[model samples]
Target: MRVVVIIPSRYGSSRFDGKPLAPICGRPMVQWVYQRASQSSRVETVHVATDDERIRAAVKAFGGNVMMTASTCRSGTDRVAEAAERLGLGMRDVVVNIQGDQPLVDPRCFNAVVKPFTEDPSVKMSTLAFAIVDEREITDPKDVKVTFDENGDALYFSRATIPMGRDGFSGYTIYKHLGVYAYTREFLECFRSLSPGRLEEIEKLEQLRAMEHGHRIRVVVTPYDSPEVDLPVDIRRIEEKMAAMGIG
Candidate 1:
């Protein structure tokens, strides 16, 4: 089971421009992501997929593998699929799509995501989910929620809180959907062939496309909590965490 981790990074960002190149501590954000992915024992190779020449050069400067993708890619999944085709990923190989902004992503999360493929040969797509610790996250539209079946396969993913509790609903479990995904080459080809579903358009979640096409997506639960950098103020929180951890 050879696994390749692809970090999709683009220079243009609406919230924080040049986010991939932003310096975290002494290194670029993407560099941190790449380094973390490389630590995964299950991952055979790590590649940074980007559209900007500056990002490509930066990855190269750090002696990291990088691939140039087209600017027209609508999402990170699309970018990774293009890279998989460009790199000639065989049908049997597994490709893990890792988020570029999550500089502090847990290596264990990557390992857990790819583990399902090893257990079940039929599993084509997989992702990670974390139990929400705060009640505020349950109602926050930005924090996507996911519900799974008895087999731990995802039934639905939505921006709104699912399994609506009764009037006095208390202690109801909630899970926050992580953006990381693992896809087999055959699933990637099938994913590209489907049209975006109405639910996906309504929620702006690309994973819904797979469910719409009747494909089962295995859900893996991870105990690690990742702090994402989405706004300018987020840099301060990450810096403070790094300082406390002595990561430089």
Candidate 2:
């Protein structure tokens, strides 16, 4: 039942290079994420998993724990699985995967994502979801939408509008998939081993791989919204949001 937070970082980004090291409110984005994640009362430890030495150095410079994974890792999940193996986490230990790009992730989101594991031993993986309040996000490809079953298990995660109204129906709520995720160390290892699924490759949503493999991911609805830094301009937006929230 140890909860370990791992942030998969990379120095290169097609949209914004050195994204993990990018400064936000006078601190590197990764540092902000690490510090916030550490604030979670449920988290036992936090580690920055990166293939780049500069990101490793940056995390180390900030007195944060970091581990180097194989550069060949194609996604955050792969890097986290490797980091989990290196850290020697037990099979049942809960591994929280917090994306480095989300500097303003609420510490409470960590607890929300990890709660399912404690309540249900069969829950091997879980993720946060928020009911979309902003109207524009419903059709925005950048905002991934998720549909869940009555039991809160994810039915689908997509970039396109889900529960599409063929006849202009608009009564349903669309949930935005928050980047935060949690997995048992064993399932994480299994996730990394499985080949990418067709829907995962098509939608470019890695979470779909689990569903395609018949794995039911519990969707934890959370009130907190964690925005990501996709381009250089997003830093200022995050800073503004942080400042408005009185958060550094």
Candidate 3:
């Protein structure tokens, strides 16, 4: 099956306005994300799905493929679904939804998210999760926690800490959810048709809709932590990290 990476970028963001156009070094933030996604060997094609003409123009200026989606789309996943349909993607093709705000996302993370489906055809969708090493993060509502079964298929995802082990249960793991997602074209269409779930509404995580509907989400853990840019102060940290890694 052919794999395509679709990055959904909207100019308006509640926390950081015009985030996709934000400058990271010499290029816009979206460019960095597009470049990184393109580096993934598993992804056969990359497309940026955006509502703003400015974002479309910027992507085109960089010689990146872009699809103009309807502004009414509520979420990035929805935008990707529209793009996939517009592009005439087949049911067997895999669509990787790469977040536009994550400029530092490694190509390997994209690979990790999609690798499982190749091994098991039953894996309809998947995402990345990292262990929360910091104790402070365990209690942070902003950090979405996840727990999976022995087979590495996700059982649940919540903004609240999961597997609330009692009586000093130390060995149990706490994982923070990563925004990246890889889904078959068929599942994405199905996802758009389904209504939001209870835990999803409470946690405000759209992915939960999959779990609520009995769809299994395979979890892949990544070594590198991709910090999302939410505020202006985060730019310095991303710049520092990029500089340290010799990435311009």
Candidate 4:
């Protein structure tokens, strides 16, 4: 099965406009994400899906592949689906959606996300989750939490702490959801056709739509932490991380 990585980028953002173009260590944030994704040994192709001319130009300037999507895409997933359709990918192929803001995303995580599909044919969708090291992050709305079944299938995703910690946060492992996702081309088309679910609307987490529709989302536990750039202030933090990692 072919594994394609699609990074959805837009120049407009309520928090940080033109975020994809923001420079980090002399490269645009989108380039950093694209470069890291390109290092994934499992990925056959990496493309930046965007509607903005500036973003397209930047991706081209870096000699990266890019596809123009409609500006009216409801979500990043929608943009990815559009790009995959335009590319004429087969239904059995895997399409990975990597967030453009994640400049420091681990390339190995790409391999991990696609493992479920290789090991089990039943896995139509898969995502990564990390053990919450900081207790404070459990309550933070910005950091989404996920609860999985005994089989490692996601039960629910929420902005609030899940499982309620009825025992006072002991004997339970809380997982923080990572933004990375891999979906079969068939399932991705099905996903876009489904209307928003009530739980998804309430939590504002789109992944819940699949669960609400009775589709199982395999949750892969990853040790890597995804540092996303949400605002301008986050640039320094990412740059510091790059410096510590000896990245030029």
Give the C-alpha miss distance for residue 209 in model 4, angstroms.
0.7
Q: Rate the local accuracy (lDDT) of all candidates.
A: 0.90, 0.93, 0.90, 0.95
Candidate number that wins on lDDT, 1 or 4: 4
The lDDT, on a scale of 0 to 1, for candidate 3 is: 0.90
Off by over 4 Å in 3: 167-172
lDDT string for model 4 (120-202, tens) is: 99999999999999899888899999999988999899999987866788898889999999999999999999999999999
Best by lDDT: 4
Ordering by lDDT: 4, 2, 3, 1
* Higher-ranked by TM-score: 1 or 3: 1
lDDT of 1: 0.90
User: Candidate 2 on 81-190: residue-level lDDT in tens?
Assistant: 99999999999999999889898899999999999999999999999999999888889999999999999999999999887988763777889999999999999989
TM-score of each: 0.96, 0.97, 0.95, 0.97
Model 2: lDDT equals 0.93
Ranking by TM-score: 4, 2, 1, 3
As a whole number from 0 to 100, the lDDT of residue 216 in candidate 2 is 90
Off-target runs (Cα >4 Å) in candidate 1 are: none
Give residue 206's error in model 1 in angstroms: 0.5
The digit string of per-residue lDDT tens for model 3 on 155-208 reads 888877787878653887689888899999999999999898998888899999
